[model samples]
Target: MSTLIAGTPLAGRVAVVTGASSGIGEATAERFAELGAKVALLARRKDRLEDVAERITSKGGIALALPTDVTDRAAVRAAAERISVELGNVDLVFANAGVQLISEIGDLKTEDWDAQIDLNIKGVMNTIQAFVGSLEAAGTDGRPADLITTSSIAATRVLEKFQVYSGTKAYISHITRLLRTELGRKNVRVSTVEPGMVNTELPDHVTDPDASKLMADLIHQIDVLQSADVAETVSFVAALPKHVNLTELTILPTAQII
Candidate 1:
């Protein structure tokens, strides 16, 4: 069992977690709440969001479930505004919502490619643009605030049928690096978590039959990392001291490989 020492590191802080309906996002929200942060859960599914919120509340943690679609700029902005108004200045923002599609270039559908770009790229942009001001505002207190995003190992390695998906993740990595440079002077920290072979709904989005089979086989071949693994990493980054920023972390199951 992992022990949680609670009091100062994240006490009285407010965090917004996008894609909080399930998977890594949901896990991260729960972990943050456990660490004494008031958490805002944002995702498109109202029922699912409420469920997560209820879980946190039941556990004696503060939580708000805001049904949101990260792909919609206006919705994202409104969510951010509401968090600022209700939760006070935001202390952390986790742009953890994403999708994946795998197909060969010849068989790849244009619409699918666009979907990946919009959510994986543009969605991230909207989250950052919406909450950046809040992060800046929080910095005035002389404490470091954080912005974290989830990228996959695919970003670094180009696997056989995941061209567009890999492209989107690669873009995430690039944006994270640039944002780190841009936000450094502002006392806001930016970090990226790259996870490999996690057991989640990621494979459900794979439309290509061949690719789906391949992914399933790979999962069976390894004791895939769980969503909790990535969640722990997010909490670790958030718990770091003001001047110490864990820039990037890559996690993979012991049996998995590039």
Candidate 2:
């Protein structure tokens, strides 16, 4: 009922954010809180989530730290139920849990591939499955319910050593688009956000030396995208008018050609 300029557009709204321990997910949760949303932070790190919740609560925003592994369907479901009971029906769900382990196809690490598939793909599915019902149930209360996933530019670009990671992201991007078609009729908006070279722990998780060096060089050469940049994109999409759904957004640094 409030405008983004006049006051908190998300005031009185309930938002659930996965991967809230750090990076873009954490930034987005904090931004949502600043906009007066009651935020539920979900992640595997209880300590980190607690720290984030403390920061939000100290600033007069409501926050709940729920340590959850997105890869676990039952746990994700339980966390969603808890948030619904404690805060209210979720108006926004940020399915942002992911991992980036890069290696060339010839030297592929099967374990790493499995880990990426589980978190990057299955995790996204679990997050959406857990909260979509709530979003569907929440009719247009002046603003449409939103579900946004943190996809990546790798979905479309063929970054060396990122075959598995890119594959997972591509799946997410396609899935989000399909969901929009089904959920739009119910006033539930689904969006996929693809960001390029964000300064986050994602690159830190890279194990391949060549890939690491390539990423490091890119970061050093170009003014890299920050977590807040992606977070701002998430907030903007969430704050848009009910009829205006930004179904897909691709954010890249000016210098980033890929």
Candidate 3:
């Protein structure tokens, strides 16, 4: 994310990214660090999180990996406390952790639905609760602060077998808007990035045969957005002037009709 970007615009800032184990989360964290922001990585995949932190450090960047289950509010809070002591108050946060489980409505994949709800919706709430205080403080002190969430084009696109996933993303997009009512007053920028069909490990987790085939066909047919592409867009959102807030951003490949 940094190599493509021009200067150290984010220097001296502290940024946190959830779902840092892979894909968008990993790309965003690395980019922020490269831009000179102290980074904290949060994810359930401890090994991968550590690996990501090592990659940032190898590049002479500062990063702290804190393995966390974002669904658990308590764990999120604990990690926030540690970040405060070690990295100072975080000024930018990318609540990017989420899961995609595609299944038919008649199939009633309760487990899959629960997993998406827990990690996508509940996890976002936990992250916001854990760090909003610091963001508020930063804003009150006339500092730059941002709270950004990773939503999806599914929130508005009507895709078959993506009912539950779409609902979860819709919640995220709308919630970001609502959060701005208060956080914006504090001078903290709150926004959401909704990306279409990024080529990532997310699709590999699809269990339904028809849904999997549909996603496969789409990827094979057209150019899909890469995780790094989304990361760059997100980094742009964060690096924007504090007075400007791109409240909702939708990123998609030029060839992607949907």
Candidate 4:
């Protein structure tokens, strides 16, 4: 079986990335392709996924764009099944679909809370449910399989006005750790990548005017980390030796804390 090394550790592997239309998810998909993995990009926007797939194909990488919404269990399952049929097997799964909404507990809208929970929490569960079997099969065939989920520093640090968003991230961190315990014996690695203040469309999902202003201010005050930084970290974790599992990684700019 081939292994991902520093240069191109993902060579000959198959990776399925959720929320691949933009931001960290898209960046991670591109990086996986660059490392020689056959990548399947799954997202709701067919046009955006196709564009990314075209770019990968143009660069001599193998890619398939599957229009999907991670929040939909049936759709996510179908996408995984399609990848298994077409790409052979999934060696890695990135459960990266997430949203950010900032609202004070007193002022929080129920709909905003539900949206965040559905995407950030339920979506990760859906991705894992859809791909764990394929990932296990990949390992049985002597291929190392990995499950990487995107969490956030919010999971650890709770600030004012981010109650629901922080809670959702905390759930991700908890569930990934539990999965690591359960899957370790199966030789299927599980890892969570926690990033701080990344520059992405995550903040754009915020609808509250006051909350958005506060978040924008905080983002501008700090040198917000880029999606590429987190994507590189994802690659590094996925490239580890079969026996080596990086259970958790938290990355933040040197100048930022909490």
Q: What is the C-alpha lDDT of each candidate?
A: 0.88, 0.90, 0.93, 0.87
- Show the lowest summed lDDT stretch of 10 residues, model 1: 1-10
Global lDDT for candidate 3?
0.93
TM-score of each: 0.96, 0.95, 0.97, 0.94
**Candidate 3 TM-score to native:** 0.97
Assess candidate 1 and give its lDDT: 0.88
Which 10 successive residues of model 2 have the least lDDT summed?
1-10
Residue pairs clashing in model 1 are: none
Identify the leading candidate in terms of TM-score: 3
Runs in model 4 deviating more than 4 A are: 1-6
lDDT of 3 by residue, 84-115 (tens): 99999999999999999999989889999999
Superposed model 3: Cα runs more than 4 Å off: 1-4
Q: Which tens-of-lDDT digit does each residue in 205-225 have in candidate 4?
A: 787788687667768788778
Candidate 4 or 2, higher lDDT: 2
Expressed as tens digits, the lDDT of each residue in 1-258 for candidate 1 is: 264545546777899999999999999999999888899999999999999999999999989899999999999999888887887788799999999987778964888899899998999999999989888777767776999999999999878988888899989888888987888788899999989988899899897898788779878888888888888888889898878899888999888767
Better of 2 and 3 by TM-score: 3
Looking at model 2, residue 197 earns an lDDT score of 86
